[model samples]
Structure formats: structure tokens, C-alpha cells
Target: MDDRRLTDWMEGYVRAWNSNDPADIQALFTEDAVYLTEPYAEPWQGRNAIVRGWLEIKDEPGQTTFRWEPLAVEGDLHLVQGRTEYRIDPPRSYRNLWAIRLDGDGRCFEFTEWWMKEPLPE
Candidate 1:
């Protein structure tokens, strides 16, 4: 797949996330895609689990926005950095490291996100 298409697909995925629609979020992945968060947490496997995981975040309090910056692209692999803002009165921000693998047909097969957020120092 071309980098342009991959970037566009990634943008669509982020749009789905921003929409907070569980089905839209799950549409980014393949049927058996694996999504791992951190190390020990049981990785969400398959589309159903991914949809459930996203449902937990849908309709969460506060305004959330995401900004994606492409880092590197090699063949079907894409690395990107993302900034997420949880716009509470105090506002919270998260930095995310994302590795995305795209299939030959331009669909994503796996996406792993690593992120860190420190509480707004109260």
C-alpha cells in the first residue's frame, strides 16, 4: 500500500475514535487483529474484543481530541506519534506511540498503541 493511502486510512481511524462510535472504531481493524495495551494486560484479540474495549471509552466525560504525527513509514509498516487531550477544566494530555501494520489490501491487520499520561499535578 502507498504511504498516502495508509495515512488517509489512519486519519479515518482517528475520526472514528473522535466520533466515539464503537462500531466505527472497530471498523479500522481486521477480523482477527490483535491490540495490545502495555505488557501484562490481556491483549484484546479479534474485532469483538476491540469493539468492547472502545465501547468503554465511548461517551466518556470531558472532551477528547487526538492529533496524529507520522514518524516513519517503511513498506506496510507505519509509526506515528499522537497527542491526546482530555479537555477537562484542568485539561489532561497523553502522548501516544503507535505502530500500525497494513495489509496488502490496504486494511489494517494490527495496531499497537503505547501511551503515557500523568495526572494533572493536583
Candidate 2:
């Protein structure tokens, strides 16, 4: 996918993260989308499962902020580097890598994420 399409989809992802609305989450994926919280984990398969899985473990609205940059695009595969900072006592942060495959319609058909907690302040 092109940068513009990827940017639009990323924006939708941030919106979905902030909203946790079923429709918002559903709009980002295809009907048969696969979403993995980690590369090796079993994925949330299909739109309904994805929506249900997300809501079950969702972050509260406005609980965190995310920033990401596109790293690569080869065919339909996209890679992103990201940071997530949670708004909670003592604070928390993570470094994230995402692999996404978007459909022609710019909705993600497959997604996997890898993340590490940022080192705590000494």
C-alpha cells in the first residue's frame, strides 16, 4: 500500500485505540482479519473474534498514547516502529514493532505486533 493509504489506516488505528468502539475497531480490519498481540501467539481470527478479543483486553479510553513511524513497505507488507506511553501512576512505556498486511481496500487483513517494556528509570 502507498504511504497515504497507510497513514490513513494508522490514523484509524489510533482512533480505534482511543475509542474502543466496536465499529471503530471493526473498520480497521477485513471481515476475515487476523490480529496477533505477539508474533508467536494465537491470533484473534476474523472480524467478530477480533472485536470480541479486543474489547476483552482493551485499554481504557485515553489510557495511553502511541507514536509510530513507517519503517518499510514491500508489496502489501508494512512495518512500523512505535512507542507507547501509558498514563498511569509511576508511568510505563514500551517500544513496539508492528507487521501489517493491508488489503486493497486499506483495511488490515493480517497484523502482528512485538513489544518490549522500556527500561525503568534508575
The candidate maximizing lDDT is 2
Error of 2 at 27 (Å): 0.4
RMSD of 1: 2.6
Error of 1 at 35 (Å): 0.8
Candidate 2 local lDDT, 1-122, one digit each (tens): 35877898999999999999999999999999999997567899999999999999999998999999999998889999999999998899999999999988999999999999998788
Q: Put down candidate 1 lDDT per residue, 1-122, tens digits, no spaces.
A: 34776777777787776676766776688889887867788888888888888777564633787888888889878998888888777888899998888877666778788999956876
Residue runs of model 2 more than 4 Å from their true location after superposition: none
My TM-score estimates for the predictions, one after another, are 0.84, 0.95
Give the clashing residue pairs of candidate 2, or none. Answer: none
Q: After aligning candidate 1 to the native by TM-score, how far in Å is the CA of 89 from where it should be?
A: 3.5
lDDT of each: 0.79, 0.92
